[model samples]
Target: MATFRREKCTINITGTNRAVRIAGASGGFSDRQRAISSLARLDVDIIVGDWLSECTMTLHGAQKMENEKLRAEGRLMEQPAGLFDPTFIENLSPALPDIARKSIKVAVNAGACDAKLLARTVENEVKRRGLDLKVAYVEGDEVTDVVNRLIKGGEKFTSLMTGKDLKDWEYTPIYAQCYLGGAGIAEALKNGADIVVCGRVADAAPAVGAGMWWHDWNRDKDFDAIAGGLICGHLIECSAYVTGGYFFGFKRLMDGCANLGFPIAELFADGHCAINKEPDTGGKVSIGTVASQLLYEIQGPLYYGSDVTANIEGVVMTEEGNDLGMTAIGGYQAEFHVYICGLDLEAKAEWVEKQIRHSAGDAAKELSCSKFSLNGYCPDNPRNQDVATCDLRIFVQTKNKKLVDKSTLDVPGFNRWCMDNGLQGCPGWTLGNDQRQSEGKIYYEYYVSLLPQSEVQHRVVFPWLGGNTLDVKPCANMKVYPRDQPSYETSNPVNLKSFGPTTRGPMGWVVGGRSGDKASDANVGFISLLTIPKIQYLLDEEYKGGKIERFEIPGIRAVHFLLRDHLDRGFNSTSTYDTLGKNVCEYLRSKWVDIPNKFLARGRF
Candidate 1:
């Protein structure tokens, strides 16, 4: 049994749950090897290698289909996705080659298994073996089905309910994943499962489950007893992500990071675990980064893992100066297997493209005029279902809407230069608006999983492999493959324009419909105003003299402005308010008219 010695509080963590963190080397094979080696150093009960991804799966499926097609034509089949590489499973068994030596056990929760393929493999193994090796498989998408089935069947939560007892659990599923909580895994272990396999369980589920078994936890207990295991699992779920991948302030933990060994959960039965990496490791574990993650990455108001809802709200942390900050999580509860899942839908795809263009120095004036006349001469097919009315996208760095509007119109005149021009592919002196892709519509798909009637499948293993091969060489690959692009219906017509890259220089502001607006090339001597928009705005304000200078608001960090240059005021200026108070008041009132004085004063505005 694991135990914790707390100095300030009586912390008692109970339950069969544990977790270990592993880190990879570089990107592909090297990373896998490093991860396996890191896992080897841990004393945990189970090892989970997250290799397969949904995107990877899709790519693999497409590759397999393509390979199958080629093989039919007597052509050498191209390698399917990462299937050709053995590093994925190659690293699995090595993570702890001597686990059996220590009488310790480990299980594989296939990262993202093909449900049909895995089920068939298990069934075949069962047929081949008479060994009493207990095997268990957790479906990722069936927890809801299990809960619903229990409700309908009048089965109490306290009692053990198996999938065999459910009548409606036969729903064929594309991906059925149930995040079996630690209690469930403990029950499985108690029932004698030498090896457990699952599909799409939450990253932390297996570690927590293993910890629970190791600790011999009770099912009806409070959550704190399981919080330590839960936290440990969460830390290692993404492997090195916690150690360094996502840590922005990594310089602080550079010492304990030479070898950057994998993390370990020195878990105590009192719901507290000391998070530390392997000795001579090349990773950093500080309180700041971990706290930041706890605040950001965690999903719910209360952090919920397989067996516990760790209310990190009260998780205490202390900074040991440059050393790691010790974390103490308390006050949590377990929601059991009563997770919720909505109806499933089909997948859809979409893409977008953007383009811009402009003309060169002296020839720009003539080209601008040519484009105007050419628009009337030639036009793209106006009648196309997959297209829409094209418009000139006048992109400017200026926040000035007025300048943007003027530029939008200025682009058409660019065609005038095309007249008597020898340039061959010069858009034929046409005023072409850039074509823009439209938004995609909602797509839906039908799905079925053994949710309500699903029961736990237990005890299945084969002969040749034996229970010993729980750490066997698995045929796994992680290299991503490309898939056939899905055909999308262009319901929303795109802009009717020849969409392509353009070549042009910046446009000068038009003054009273005349070019050469200003030659105000005065250098402000400061790099701050070096941007084109700023220089233009400052020059316009100085020459035109109708500039409005806005002030920052009190108690407000940022403010939105509705600015329009080239207004009726002859000389244009930016919108600037003298008193942030009045402008802010008006702004807030416009948005919320019913806001009362007390609310505004209370900073609830």
Candidate 2:
């Protein structure tokens, strides 16, 4: 057994002589069986499973509350009594004996909102199977009561992403859970627990704990090591992400990815880790594969966690071995979001852009906004009166939450006002889904805030050890910075006169894209198949959007364009129909663009 002690800002590693190996099993709430089977085949010291995503937490909380209500009402059979990831038991049951025999520890966030209950269930199952596995659970991330108290005390629970307060919201939160760190998991491991379960801990916390326990690293003194572990946890937390699962060039791995092997990290004491996979398993681990996962769902260079901050801006990725890559991270925020919905209208992109500029109160002031065609109708052929309408979707974000709320709520009023002007307004003036469009529905917003380490009641509970609980707390050295607003700038004008012969076609025919939400903002990245010297014309004339940043990745032959702050307040908080911004890429792809006829002759578009 290894032990770690903190002494005056220094970490002393004792009772350990070598590097540690940790494997990531299931990524989300699916494919547990495959993950467990892979775990059985891999020779790792510990297995970290990530079962909770942002949406899953909310869903599980709602389900748990509903089940509690049913049980209180004496209708116990109305709904099944189970946690969000019940399949975890089914996945781990068959592997429990092997895991116990090999002394391979397990950690997971499968508990969702009920860590104790899930731990008890797993303990009973292990006992019934005559397995001697000790199950420990980590709690105290549930902050529903705290949130309620704060709201009662007049805390607005402002949106860290959009800077909108809770007073402007119409929906009340049913549950609130903070993202705990790996301190409790490390404490449980120290106390000889073989399996650790947690609720709403950071997605990568399990691996971080396993690394800390294996290497005898302290979070306070070994900031670099802990930060490295944090990045390692994130890289492999998604199971196959670091092993070519979600790579953009996935077609290359499709044949070998039938049973994509989960990722494993060889964590060193010096804050450097090597990412790899099980032998004879599918998926490749290379620089590109690792970089793809590193860039996934990340907002910027600074990756903040409850326990430590990982600064990956200067980190370098290089191949260390066949199917292995290595990177180091050093230690370094709180954030929350809100969603507003039911604002729908139809108009041309130019008209919508002008309207947004007018609404912002200054035509010259740069406003963060995005507009996309719903393809509901053809805008180019307005003479086809038989084609009744086209839906032009728009989204905006500002410091004024009340103004946004009012904007959505006053859709009917705006429509009436437009009708008053009659012929003066844009031709074919109309709104979509008139009834639902008039009534804006407030969504329960996600508020991200920081809690002091001293305030977090972290503990480890051993279900097998007479249900004992050991108190623990995360390191207090982490410094969180306040959330800052995203800035936007107009793209440099493009020289369109030098272009040769071209044919107009859907941009999707010649480009590939990926789009995702980042707090209140939505980022969409596009890769052009043909060499595009300048795209400012397309940005200004076709998209009529702002904050366009372009760059190129080495070894990749395409230029990439990132449109920032494009989805307003993002999913669950945005008024647009494409809340998640998933459709933004498709919308961009569907746009008509003039492509060089030479490339079209090559049959590429």
Candidate 3:
């Protein structure tokens, strides 16, 4: 076998300009490691990886908390606690040769808590390999200490959901990291950083930086271009997401794709980009997938980034008035999961749920939200024990952590409640060895809010410059964007009779969209090709939740719905199997909607 390498990167600087192709090499720290090497072998100019999110941040915070406690108890640790995800080095080391060979620039926010360590590690790897590559680390996303000081200096650190100050939060603050823009990333790439590792830079920041560096785009001078890059970056940051990973039409791709292809954004100087994937890959690149990623985890049309507010006005993103305030149920949450296997699964599930709730006694009444969700049913007949299983999830959210914390003597612990019913449970009763559920280690309230650009102090560390730093300033001429953009005058009427003949079918057959969370609320942007459509949601009696405010974007022929506070205070607190709200779209698609006969005739649901 011979090593394949590109002679040099093909830059598009001539009159007949070509788009700078940036491949989404990694969606997260845990994404397929082969993505970087695989995409680098293709015609990509730059490879960008995203590694931070609220979920990951919470996990990192938990790790820090655990290690602190262990050190306090004078426990011997093998490796000193890592502020950054060490997986970055694991994911990057094998791909560096290909990346360097292809002359492909790279950026990744694998620096969960420490950019310097990861950046230095990558630089050392390059040096050891004798590769001519520049490695830089973007910093200042970590601001826990700064936040604490500011809190004492009269900064409320108000909850974005409740508008209550951090002081009102019953539990002591764990840590805070601010969301940063692409400015720091762009600076690194422009200053000749072949590889840029970052911490807490926005998910799409890698792509945004690549586009800015490739096009020489100034945020203030090129707002639309910047916004365009922002939107493009948003669309492809989730790797295969916009190319059929969470798509409604996933079955169609299952025929050929063993795995979905990582997304690549075809970046142009004008700001607009075309999203595609490597040819012959498992997934597809279509309007449905692109729109699905666009609507993922988004709040409204005015998509605010630290650098610029990218308005999705013409493409039609909007949110009807939300009942969004003080929706955090009890704040602190305690949860436990028990898997039932083999025969009498339902009976076993019932026993666990029943006993867990009953054991709480009087304290159960005080819970803001108590949900016992029976998820995943075992199939009938002819399968192994592993296949014949279902999960019994017990969630308790209350104002006080002690109510859920297993160590507290305040009330009966959820873990104890779950385990005590083991003997009484049905034939398949089982419990996991993980004691954290009982210990209340799985409880945390997630809050999302913005910090000023000045506060973040976005900067880059150049390893080639002997660890010298460069400050990346926010846009000088930033625009004050209005919260609401003009929604297309598409009327979303719920009159089922208006569409003439109707048939009961899964909503998936008629339309496609994406669902994700903005804090606790789930936003599902429903896209349909037809306008003047009459649709109604026929949720059964089992449905119980907050107001679903619906809006329509005639331009894109999409109906957007915000399921206010649907996730039980979002991912960390939510007992739902689909913590990120990624499954909401598919779940809604599975619902039997009154599909117009014309849509059925068209055979494009």
Q: Residue-wise lDDT of candidate 3 within 1-605, one digit each (tens)?
A: 00111113233455535667888877776777778778878888898888766777777766666677788998849676577876677777787788888789988888887787777777788888888899898888777677667767887656554446667766666667777778788889889888888888778778878878888887667776777777877877888887788777777778756777787777777777777787667777776677677777776556766666665655322111111111122256666778777766666666677777677777676677778777777788837777777777777666655643243322356566777777777777677656565444345667655455656667898877888999887677644433333333244435668779998878888778888877777777878632212222433432344555555555556666655567765767676676887777777677776788977897764
Winner by TM-score? 3
For model 1, the superposed segments whose C-alpha errors exceed 4 Å read 1-31, 41-46, 52-87, 115-178, 183-195, 253-259, 314-605
Q: Candidate 1, residues 1-605: lDDT per residue as tens digits?
A: 12222112222434443332212222222343666546556554445444433223323333444465678887953533333223544454453334444334444445233432443444444345433334554443223344455546775332011213223332221222333444444445555665455544445555666666766645345355566666666665555544553343445556654455555455555555555545545665555334322332332223444345554434421100000000111111110001111111010000000111233233223221111100011125435322322222221111111122232223232222222132332221222332221111111111111222125332223322443222211112111111111112223433323433322212111000001000011101110102233333434432333222221111212111112121211111111211111122122122211222332342321
After TM-score superposition, the amount by which residue 320's alpha carbon in candidate 3 deviates from its true location, in angstroms, is: 21
| lDDT winner, 1 or 3 | 3
Q: Relative to the unseen true structure, what is the Cα RMSD of model 1?
A: 23.4
By TM-score, the candidates rank as 3, 2, 1
In model 3, the worst 10-residue window by lDDT is 318-327
lDDT of 2: 0.61
Q: What lDDT, from 0 to 1, does candidate 3 have?
A: 0.69
Better of 2 and 3 by TM-score: 3
Pitting candidate 2 against candidate 3, the one with the higher lDDT is 3
- Measured over all alpha carbons after superposition, the RMSD of each candidate to the real structure, in angstroms, is 23.4, 11.6, 6.2
